[model samples]
Target: MHRSLLAGTFLLLFTTAASLAAAGSSTGLDDEIEGESRPAPSSQIPLPQEGDKPEAENGEPPEGNVTRPDTREETPIPDVLYDISALPEPVQRMRKLLMDAARSGDIENLRPLIGTGANRTQMALGGLEGDPIEFLREISGDDEGQEILAILLEVLEAGFVHLDEGTERELYVWPYFFSVPLEELTPAQKVELFKLVTAGDYEEMRTFGAYIFYRTAITPDGEWLFFVAGD
Candidate 1:
């Protein structure tokens, strides 16, 4: 009975040893297959660079995009003024008066001087006063207004160039209505007259002129401005 038990124990030990050996061999085969199928490490893969980046199939920059210059250019404006002497005498006269009125703030006497011809009627003042410069801006309307302005500009240029030196003379070409003598105005007043004559025929000029003069004062420049407007 002892001998039979020893033999059975030996057989069991052998079977166990064989099973362990087969498992070791199967494990080694699985490891080899896994190593062959696995992908390479991330560091080994190729990557794109800025210069090497792929472009659109059509070769244009991507959709909804455009390129522009870094700097912008400025446009130039045109010169509009013509020679001063080329304008008519009446235009020249009106330009002078408008500028004169501007500097003086003389409106009361400026009204009757508006409109063409000796039989001219008074225009609506539109209730402006105190500042004839502002009035000159108002009375002159549109291109017609521009004519007055251009003329004034010409006269201004002329006065500055030709009459620049010597005694500053005020040209008294007679008032239209009252037979009052042309008063020798203060230098300040003379400057006002210069502005009135040159500020152009803006609507504000008329209103301001009327307000300043109210009754006695006359704009020697207004009639000529009106005549220029007609032409």
Candidate 2:
């Protein structure tokens, strides 16, 4: 009976050991399956910093990133004057001389009024090399200086402006367009301008940013300062 009891005790101990080993194996299998089914954590991407510019395909700054500047200038328009009777006596006299010479149809008549030495009327910006009258003829469309005479007459007849008032550099410029901004011209003022230049010429001047046509300037003391074209 003691021997039978010992054998039964050994069998019971063996069965309990087997059950514990099976439970541990099942638990380990479940843990491995769960790990495989779970989703992975995503990697993060960093954002660009402020003021950092993206490079173009050519390695330069992107065209959209650059800012361009406006180069056009804003100029004030001066008053236009039609009647020259209110102008100074010397200024009036000089205008009369220019008018009479132009009306006479004789380009040579302008010789005396053009003066001599340092005070000569500036016919060209760089100074005249040959005969002034011959130069005038060459510049005229007709080759006889008739066109130049006509131009002078038209310029003097148009409105003018008294600029730099009270200063030694004061001048009375013809057509008044020299001192007035082209963009600021009124419809009536444009009509006055049309008398001197064609619509095509006006458009060209506008594109050029300022009038670059032939303009006359006379000093306050009746000296003809310049009668030339260009900027």
- The candidate scoring highest on TM-score is 2
**Candidates' TM-scores?**
0.21, 0.66
State the displacement of the C-alpha of residue 135, model 1, in Å, after optimal TM-score superposition.
10
C-alpha local distance difference test of each model:
0.26, 0.56
RMSD vs true structure, all candidates:
46.2, 42.6
TM-score, predicted candidate 2 vs. hidden true structure: 0.66
List model 2 lDDT by residue over 1-231, tens digit each. 122222222122112222322323222211111111211111011111243322222222223211111123653355788778888889899999999999998888888887644455555322233355655554454546676777778888889888757854466888688777789899998988777776766777798776555577677788875665444
Judge candidate 1 at residue 6 and give its lDDT: 22
Q: What stretches of model 1 exceed 4 Å from their correct place? A: 1-79, 116-231
TM-score of 1: 0.21
